[model samples]
Target: MPEKTTAENIFGSIVETLAESGSKQKSVSFFGEEKSNPVASQFNRLFGRQKPVYNLLGGGKSADVLLWRNKKVSASFLTGATAIWVLFEWLEYHCLTLVFFALVLGMLAQFIWSNASGLFSSGRSQTKVPRLVLPEEIFVNIAITISAEVNRALSFLQDVASGGNIKQLLVVLASLWAAAVLGSWFSFLTVLYVGIVAAHTLPVFYERYEDQVDSFVYKVLQQIQDNYRKLDDGVLSKIPKGKLKGKKFE
Candidate 1:
């Protein structure tokens, strides 16, 4: 090989220095190894990071574009949904199936309209293809999270094998089984939506007519208490009580 010249020596030294610096630098990742205590840092110590709520993406291409329309749309959707739910409940109607059917019918109608006219205001809907919403990394991350959940579930089974509370374990298993069976048919989402509706309306209604609601509740409670007292005297009184004189953990 030919002798290394002065310029070649300088270039080689610069490359070596860059490689050393790059190796020592911390990697920039979506998630870091550092455990963030969100409850303590962000929430408990509000303004700890001193971040501005507005203009977070200040230096981006979409800088100064607040997208207030998105926020307004969300607020409108929530308000409209709540009003509809209240009206439907008052009318004694189940709207879950209706909502699902309406969505399907609406999409089909739009597709037919697009095919016939091909003049959608947003774009030519008939010509446009459905785009992927998430990045490839997002799908990989979701799969990893699901695998972690499955691992934890399997770990619970391992604990059950290692002489865990059989009664408690069995009860939990039974509850999960029943939930899965019901969820398969009626759907957990439908249950959650109904629960939300009940929460929004029932408490307000009860508080508005507190006296009447409480009187009805009290009568039902009185009947329950009488039955409970009878059962306690007949059955529970005959059951042997556990000793509480131990100093050690159960």
Candidate 2:
């Protein structure tokens, strides 16, 4: 047999190891829904959907601009939306009294502001700010990915390695371990690992969302996971059966 150099042998081993280990994580689901254009979905998901009410983008009636121009009327809509989301969260946390208080106070503020500032406005030709256009689906997907990784790490450490810690201790330590492991994994892989796999099966998850919009991140993740599961199963089975060899370095 031809003598293989140390560098070649090491690179070959690394490639083989990666190819083998890759399959185990191939099937894991990251996020809840599928996305077509993640950045747009993220924007809509975060800032709430843009309405035809005000032309925030040029050639439009600037609701926020109008609010700035005539603080009273604009404040009502702005405050109302803010309060609604805030109140929703408060209610979710079971803070009924606080929600009631917020409602009462929010109503009073809107009432006072509406009377004080007359609702009159015009569109301004101000330049728009440049921003990273990550979609809601992508944002959600990333969050889900991070959460799943952390959860997996903790579960692996706690359940698989029983007697490692008490319940309270497990809760504390698991959170910490999960964060560290997740951070490390993200730092190492970036999106290339998942992105590559997602490319193969795009059509499988290409369902439309509300309206005519499609989600990108969700679909990508779905495909990636689909491919990953297949990869993981294939690699895992071949692990022990595969042959290994050594070479000396000069």
Candidate 3:
């Protein structure tokens, strides 16, 4: 009886040990998934962005168009822009000439329609053709929007020029320099079209590969910060500034 009890005790101990180890393994796996990538977590915290990319882009019609949610509308807009670019750039068509030709064709069609309708009618009365007149509100709204955007841009430039933040000043200067370099390389219209194409494509691709992009961007930012720190420690720290002193009165 004593030997049998000893064997039962050993079996029970083995079962408890195995159960504990299994639970520990499960817990370790759960926690591992929860803390998979510390860098991604740090990136999210640094940016303070808890929303998804779609919401970051305002999550409306504009975002939908950019992300290609409505494929028909998005494709139509892209095709129209491509057509216009091709017409002007490849075909060498002048904007004013195109507008003149379009207007002449529209006027001729309307005139023919009006005259034919009167000729077909039994009565000898002339039919009045409807004129195409744009609304005053459309022009007024466009002007107001343009003025507001211009004022906003001017305010931003003034603020940047006021020189409170050295970092901001450097960034603005770098951006302007980059823009100048790009202007030297390509015409304004080409640059604008490229920007439009980027806007149409980049957002969707970023959304699709968000995790990889975030990881890459985090590494890039970390490397930039390290380089800046090295620059500051090596060069900036060595620079000496002259002390300003008040003149003594006689």
How many residue pairs clash per model?
A: 0, 22, 0
Scored by lDDT, model 3 comes in at 0.76
> Candidate 2, residues 1-250: lDDT per residue as tens digits?
2223433554565555555434322322234343234455555431254543234333233433332445564556556644654544444434577778888997787665655444332344433333435589988999998999999977876774576557766677787787688777663233333333342222122221222122323343445565556545655444567567888799
Q: Which stretches of model 3 miss by more than 4 angstroms?
A: 1-48, 122-128, 227-250
Off by over 4 Å in 1: 1-134, 188-233, 236-250
* Regions of candidate 2 where Cα sits further than 4 Å from its true position: 1-94, 119-146, 162-250
Using TM-score, give the best candidate's number.
3
Model 1 worst lDDT run, 10 consecutive residues: 22-31
Q: Tell me how many residue pairs clash in candidate 3.
A: 0
Q: Write the per-residue lDDT of candidate 3 for residues 15-43, one digit (tens) a residue.
A: 66556544544454445433226575545
Residue 152 error, candidate 2, Å? 3.0
lDDT of each: 0.54, 0.48, 0.76
- Cα lDDT tens digits, model 1, 1-250, are 1223433554565566555433332221122433334344333322232443233434332322232224555345547666766556555556787788888997887677657566554564455534436679989999999999999988877787676788968977897898788888764445666665554445445334333334334444555565556556655676799988858876
Model 3, residue 178: displacement in angstroms? 1.5
TM-score for each predicted model, relative to the true structure: 0.29, 0.19, 0.71
